[model samples]
Target: MKGETEGRFHTPDVSSITPGPRRATLRTADGVRIEAVHDPCAKGPADTAIVVAHGFTGAATKPAVRRAAGVFAQYAAVITFSFRGHGKSGGRSTVGDREVLDLAAAVEWARSLGYERVVTVGFSMGGSVVLRHAATHRGSGRGRTEAVAAVSAPARWYYRGTPAMRRVHWLVTRRTGRLVSRLGFATRIHTKDWDPVPLSPVEAVPLIAPTPLLIVHGDRDPYFPVDHPLMLAAAGPAQLWLEEGMGHAENAAGDALLGRIGDWLIAARPAA
Candidate 1:
């Protein structure tokens, strides 16, 4: 980071003698084209790679996601990708259901890059996906995650507890709301509801035991509320953080918080 004159502001210069964000298009097991990027660690080559799963309506190229990636890159290499139906990825968003496949692909890609250990960190809807993904692909060497962190995630499905959630439900359920979501948020939500209703985050958390789970939630979040994190924490043997004034996901995650999360990831160790 380069400071401006007279302490006005600092401009981040990620362009170094080393390579920058390596862009790629990954294909999920379900055949979704996931737009992804790899930001090498600022220090140098790293054995650990952090796979970032963004929230609903977030893209790998989005400023918020990129900022979080940059912060994490300080500690380890970072892999950021847009989920299906968001940004440049192909396919409709099943919300969190099939997004697990997208994450699996991203993790596999990270492994192919030769990173010895891979950690997943997600925000909001992405948080839910990481929980389910860790459970769904447990013990699978292909896309196995060494550790997991979910921030501002919902515990169950069809939660209409808050106005923000109600609006989210409307966007995914109604026709006109989908149009607005596509036009305004650039997110293409699927029209159909979950067929069998996959396992909830609380249910998934129990399966992720011994996998180093970390649940982070904000007390003041308008969406989901504190009960969500409480539910997730109660469902498994994991570490939990109840942030005092933090609001939502990536947008609300400042550099300081991200740095702490990075530190946690560095210190996290999975059971053998």
Candidate 2:
């Protein structure tokens, strides 16, 4: 991921490169046309490929997501795209349930580009999607994902008294999770059912053993609390970093977090 400059956001000039900015309309398994942004840098054949997923209401062009893409460009080809209903992507937010397919579509896009090593980074809601993807992809024979990194993600939903998260279940489910069952994918806030695969990153961590995993969270994050990462780290070959005084989605400029991620990637290189 790219670093921040002077505590400000910097957008990558993907058009200046050889292949330039490759724009494509990706159709998810559910037939949603997701607008994807692909930056093919001048760097030689990429040794690794990274696909990034943003948090709720975030788009591919978001400053943090773009910064992450920029940071990864130094060592790997990077791809970022909006989950349906955000930015130019189509459809509505599934609250990280069906969004896993959207993530899969993005990963497939990177694989089609001939990237040998693949890594995925997800923020908040996007983090859950990547964790689910890793669990389901193992031994499926689709392809090998080298590693996964999650930032400010929640291992379990429905936690009581979380400061970072608003009571979205009311808005998401509308009528005590009953409307979701009857209405199905027509709920107002969430267009899909509420069955989120029942798998949390803490439980899924051991499944990803032998494959490096990194979990980063803010010390003051109100949403999931620092215990989420701590529990996750105890599950498998995982490393946890708690940024002091950082809140959920802290806009710490200067690529401070991205640098940590880059260092982890180098140290956690997958086996050959």
Top candidate on lDDT is 1
Q: What is the lDDT of residue 35 in candidate 1?
A: 83
TM-score of each: 0.92, 0.80
lDDT (tens digit, per residue) of candidate 2 on 129-213: 7777777677535344678888887877666556335454554555654355325433224455676356766677788766778
lDDT against the true structure, per candidate, is 0.89, 0.69
Itemize residue pairs with steric clashes in candidate 2. Answer: 1-68, 1-71, 1-72, 2-70, 2-71, 4-255, 164-222, 164-223
Error of 1 at 142 (Å): 1.5
C-alpha positional error of residue 134 in candidate 2 after TM-score superposition, expressed in Å: 0.9
Off by over 4 Å in 2: 1-18, 175-188, 250-254, 270-272
Best-performing candidate as measured by TM-score: 1
Q: Which digits, one per residue and each the tens of the lDDT, describe model 1 over residues 199-238? A: 9999999999788999999888999899999999999888
Model 1 misplaced regions, further than 4 Å: 1-18
- Residue 239 lDDT in model 2? 75
